[model samples]
Target: MDFGVTPHDGLPLPPRVTICEVGPRDGLQNESAVLPVAVKAEFVERLVDAGHTVVETTSFVHPKWVPQLADAEDLFRAITLAPGVRYPVLVPNSRGLERALDLGVRDIAVFGSVTETFSRRNLGRTVGESLEMFAPVVARAREAGIGVRGYLSMCFGDPWEGEVPVPRVLDVATRMRALGCTEISLGDTIGVATPGRVAAVLDALIASGIPVDSLAVHFHDTYGQALANTLTAVRKGVTLVDASAGGLGGCPFAGSATGNLATEDLLWQLHGLGIETGVDLRKMVDTSTWLAGHLGRPSPSRTVTALAGTS
Candidate 1:
C-alpha cells in the first residue's frame, strides 16, 4: 500500500511531537564501552538543554544483567534535574522500583514483550509470569502517583519468533494499560516493520479504545525502515516518538536487532515535515558527535554524520 499522505486521506499530520530521548539509558546500555557516571550525567544534561522534554536517564535493572548502567543510583544522583523536564528511569521489578523511589524518581517505565520467546529470553519469564511480576510494580507506582510508561517490545517482529501478529501485540498492550500504565510505547524491536504493518497496529489499538495521545512509537533502523514507520505513525496521530542520540542502541539479547532510530535523524525528518519537537537540531548533532568521540567511533546517525562531520 502507498504510505504517502494525500490531502484527501483524512489523515492530518501532527503539528508537534514529544521526543523521549533514550540516549543515556537505552543507548548507553547496549554499548560495549561503559561510560563513567559523570559522562552519563553530562549526556543527560546536554539532551535536556537541547530541548528534550522527556529523557530516559537510566535503568534500575541489576548490575548482573546490564553492567554498563550498573551505576543507576550514582548517575541519577549526579545529574542536575532540570525543572519542567522529565527524567524517567526503567524499573525491572519491585526491587528496581524501590531503588528509583529511594532516589525520588517521578517517572518510571516497565519493559514488556509481545512475543513469548522474547519475554522468556529478555526477562527470563513467560509472558504471563512477566506481567504478573509487573502487576505489583505498576500498582505501587500508581499508588505513589508516579507516571508509569509501559514499553512493549517486539511489537512488529521478534528474532526467535519471526513475525508478530497485531493481535498479539494488542493483547500485551491492553494488559499493560489495564495495569495502570499511563502511556504505552510500541517498540519495533528488530526494526522489521514497514508502513503497512505500522498502520495495522495503530489502527487496531485505536479501534480497541486506546487513545492515540497515550501511545508512543519506538522504532529501530535495522532494516532502514524506522523513519518511514515513524512517519506513518505520526500521520495516524501518534504524538510521542522515542529516539536515541547518534543511533546508539540495540538489544544485546537479540543479536539481529540493530541501533535505535537516531534522535538527530528523526529530528531531521520531523522538522522537514513542519512538526515542532522543540529540539535544537544543531545542539543535538553536536551532542551526538561529542558522544561518538567518547565511544571512540563516529555516530551511526546519518544526519549527525552529514552535519557534524563526525567521521
Candidate 2:
C-alpha cells in the first residue's frame, strides 16, 4: 500500500505522510526501567486503534547489550496483532531474524551505519562489513515472503566522523536497497540535521535516480529541528516517516542526541497543514500519558502538552 505522500501544489507538504512509530522499540530501548510486557502490548494496541498502521514493535538483539528488550519474544507474542496494521521489528543479525521468523512476524528491519566509527561502535563491524552481514539475511527474508526495511543510521551526521557527506550515505542506501530492503530509512541518529541539509541530502538522492517512495525519514529532536526537517522532506515528495511516541528514544552512542520526533507533535503539525496522518491525536496522547503515569513523568512532546494541556 502506497503511504499517501502525493505532492500538492504551492504547499510545502505532502498529501499524505505515513508515520511508522518506533516508540515501542527505539523509544524504550534505552530506558533503565523495563516496562511490563503487558503494558507494552496494551500501549501498542491502543496506538493501533488510535490509527498507527506501522509500529516498530521490538528489537531482536542480545539481552546483554540491551537489557530492556530482553522480553522481545514475549512482547511480540503477546501483542494482539491487528490485520491492517503492520508491525516491524529491528533484527540485528541472522539470530535476530531467526527469532522474528520463529514468531511468524510479517515484517522485520535491519540497520547499518554510513560512518565507520558508528558502524564499529554500534555493531562491531565496518560499514561495508555491516552490509555484508545483512546480505544473506535480506536475501532470506525476501525468499520467505517477508518484508525488510533497512535503517541507515548517521546518514546526515556522524558522532566521531562529523558532517557525513551525501555520497557516503548514497552508497550505503544503494547497497541496502539492493540487498532487498523495501524501505531505506535515512536516520539522523543524533538529530544534528537541519532543514536545508535534509533537503540537500534527499535532493542529492533524487538526482541519483533513487525513487522517493522507498525512502523514510527518521530524525532526533536534539536541536528541536526534527519537525522542521521532516516538513522539508515532505515538500520534496518523500512519504514514509519514522517517529516515536512522546519522544521516547534517544541515540545511545551519540551524546546529547535526544529522542526521535514526537508522534503527537508530528500529528499536530501535519493535521494543521491539511496533510493526513490517519492518527487520532487524542488516543496517541492518552497512550503516552498512560505510559508516562506509570513511569512517573510528563511527556516530552511539546505539542501534546500545548494542545491537550486543558485536558
Candidate 3:
C-alpha cells in the first residue's frame, strides 16, 4: 500500500494521480435534503482551499429532474474560484452548454451513458443518436475555445440492464473521441464492479488503441468496491479519477445506487501509498462536516467520519 516505496526498488512513485472532485454536481444532485445556494458555494470554496484543482461546481440540468440542484446557475456564480484551479460544470446538451457559456465557464463536461437501455431511460436518446447530437455541441465549445470532457455512465453493471458488455463501453468511448471529447470518463453508475472486472474493462478499452492517459474512472461505492476498482484503473495507467466529498450523492435513475467514492477515502488510500494528491485532508473533512450538517446526516465516507470523531 506504500505507493512511495515499492517492494523491489523502494523508491517513490514518479508522479501521483490527479483527482477531479465532483461533489458539487454529482454529490449534491441526489441529496433529498436541499442545501442553501450560499452554503453550497461555501462548501465549494472550502474544497478549493483543501487542494482540489478541478471541482465540479454544478450541473445545468433541469430542476424538475433533480430538485436538489435547482440553483445551478446561482451556485456556479457564487462559488469563489480558486487560483490555479479549474471549475468544470456538467452540461448535458446545447442548452446546458449555453447556460455554462453565459456564466463565463471555460471548461464544461458533457455527459452520456454507454448502454442503450440506460441511455434511452436517462437521456431519452439512443447511444448513436446522442453522439450525433454532440457533434455540434463539441464544435461550438471548441470554437469558443472551451475545454470539453465526455462522461460515459454505466460503464460497469446497470440496474435496468444487468451487465454491460465491454465492447459496448468501448464503442461509446470511441464515439466520444470522435465527437472531439479529449477526455472520456468511464463511470460505474451502479457500483457493481470488482478490481478484476475493472482491469478487464480498461484493458479492453486500451487494447483498442485508446490512449490510457485520456481515460478517467468514476465509481460508486454501492458494494464498497469503488476504491479497489480505482486502484485497478490507476495501475492500468488511468490518470484522472472522479470523486465526491463526504460521498454525498447517488443516481436518481439507478436503483439503490450510492454516491461516488468519497474524496477523503480515495485521498487517504492514495496518500497512504505515497500518491500525492496536493489536497488538504483536514480542510476536506471540514467541508464534508459542514455539508453533512446542512443535510443533517453524517457523511457516508468512513475516513471523513472517523477523522471527525462522528463515526
Candidate 4:
C-alpha cells in the first residue's frame, strides 16, 4: 500500500484517492428490475467490506420517477452503518431532505444539471429553477448539521444540449458551493469527455479559484473514455473520484448514456500507478459479479469481466 512517487504529466499525484462508490444508489436506480431492499443493503455492506469508505446508499426521489429505488428509506434503515465510513444518499428536494433527516442521515447529495434542457427534462425545472429549488434544501441540511454533496451532471456533454461550455458548468458548481455544498462532483453524463477535455475543465475550475480538493470527477463509460478521463483529472490533482461497483447505471434522460466508471477498473489503474485506494480489487470484482447475477446480465466492468473470465 505504498503509493510511492507516482507522477503524471509532471504533476504530483495524490498519495491516496477517495473513491465514493455509487453502486447501491446511482448504479441500481436505472436498472429495470427492482431488487429487494435486503439485497441492496447487502450490496452496500459488501462494498464497504471491500474498503470503500464512502458508499452512496440510495435516492429519495419519488417512486414514480425511479421505481427501482422506491425502497430508499427501507434500504437506508437496513444498512449496518460502519464506523468512520460515509453513507450518502441522493436527496432531490426538501421532501427528500426531510425523509433523510427523519432517518437521522448525516450526509446527503443534491444533483443539478449544467444545461437548461437537461435540467428541465430530468428534474422538471430549468437550470436556474432547479438551483433555486436546491437552495432551501442545502440550507436546511446545513442547519440540521448534515453535510451536502452537490452533483453537477452533464458537465462535459449532454444529449439534448450537445457540448456544454466550461463556464456554464463552473457557474452551477460555484452556486452549489455557495449554497453550502461541501463537495461538488462533476459528472460526464454522456461519457464523451477525453483526457484533453477533462484537463481543460479541471484547469478552468481550478483557475476560477475553486479548490481541486472541493471537486470530484464522475465519469460514465459510454464511449469507453471514462478511465482515461479520470486519469486526466487525477493528473490535475483531483483527489476524489466516483465509481460504481458493477458499472451499474445509465442516464435515463440521456439515451446514449451508459454505466459509470467501474470501481474495479478504477482501482486497477490506481493500484498500478501506486496510488492507494484501500480497495481489494478481487473482492470488488466478486461483489460486482454477484450483483450482476441479480440483474441477469454480465458486469459492464472491464476488470470484472477479465477477472471473472466472462469476456
Whole-model lDDT per candidate: 0.93, 0.88, 0.86, 0.90
**What's the residue-level lDDT of 301 in candidate 2?**
91
The TM-score values for the models, in the order shown, are: 0.96, 0.95, 0.94, 0.96
Give per-residue CA lDDT, model 4, range 1-311, as digits (tens). Answer: 33334555566777899999998888898898899988888899999999999999999999999889899889888989999999999999999999999998999999999999889889999988998999999999999888899999999998877888988987888888999999999999989999988998899889989999999999999888999999889888999999999788978778888999999889989988889998888889889999999999999888898888643
Local distance difference test, candidate 3? 0.86
> Model 3: clashing residue pairs?
3-273
Candidate no. 4 TM-score: 0.96
| Clashes per candidate, residues 3 or more apart or on different chains | 0, 2, 1, 0
Residue 63 in candidate 2, Cα distance off native in Å: 0.4
Sort by lDDT, best first: 1, 4, 2, 3
98-176: candidate 3 lDDT, tens digit per residue:
8989999988888898988888998899988888878888889989988888999988888878888888888889989
Tens digit per residue, CA lDDT, model 2, 113-225: 99999899999999889999999899989999999999999988887898999888888888888888999899999999999899989998888878899889999998989
Q: Candidate 3, TM-score vs. the true structure? A: 0.94
Residue 45 deviation, candidate 1, in Å?
0.3
Worst 10 residues of 3 by lDDT: 1-10
Residue 9's lDDT within candidate 4 is: 53
- TM-score, ranked from best to worst: 1, 4, 2, 3
